[model samples]
Target: MLLVAPGPFALARTFVFRRYLTLRSHVVRPVAAPPVVDAARKARKLLKKRAKEERLRNFFGWCEGCGAYGSIF
Candidate 1:
């Protein structure tokens, strides 16, 4: 595997690449980084939760405590 040789010029190029490049700008930056996540993953989780709630609502027609089989229309 190719390695970064230990030298002043090598270190300078590394610094410039890290500082100016789009991909590694954060590598040079010091900040409170936000957590990276996929929105589609969250959406899928919410969709699953809503679907489960709908199924439960259908199964239990009315208030479980009262045992009233009334339509919530």
Candidate 2:
């Protein structure tokens, strides 16, 4: 119905002739992930892993700086 017709006849040709970019046919960007995003993602993962490791280590012993198990519980 409405989807088959354009708002104006002039626009129909423009729409038909336009080089539409689909998911697979997109103009290639410089890089999908920028250097900063790649670095940040890596840093975030590393920090998360380190935090888990630190928590495990503190559980086994204790962190004097954080005072995780000194007394307050």
Best by lDDT: 1
TM-score of 1: 0.35
Q: What TM value does model 2 have?
A: 0.38
Model 2: pairs clashing at backbone N, Cα or C within 3 Å: none
* Candidate 1 segments exceeding 4 Å error: 1-37, 62-73
Candidate 2, residue 54: how far the Cα is off, in Å: 0.6
Q: Candidate 2 on 1-73: residue-level lDDT in tens? A: 5566445677766766575644325666444568888998999999999999999988766456447555765
TM of each candidate vs. truth: 0.35, 0.38
| Clash totals for all candidate models | 0, 0
Error of 2 at 12 (Å): 14
The local distance difference test score of each candidate is 0.72, 0.72
Score residue 47 of candidate 2 by CA lDDT: 100
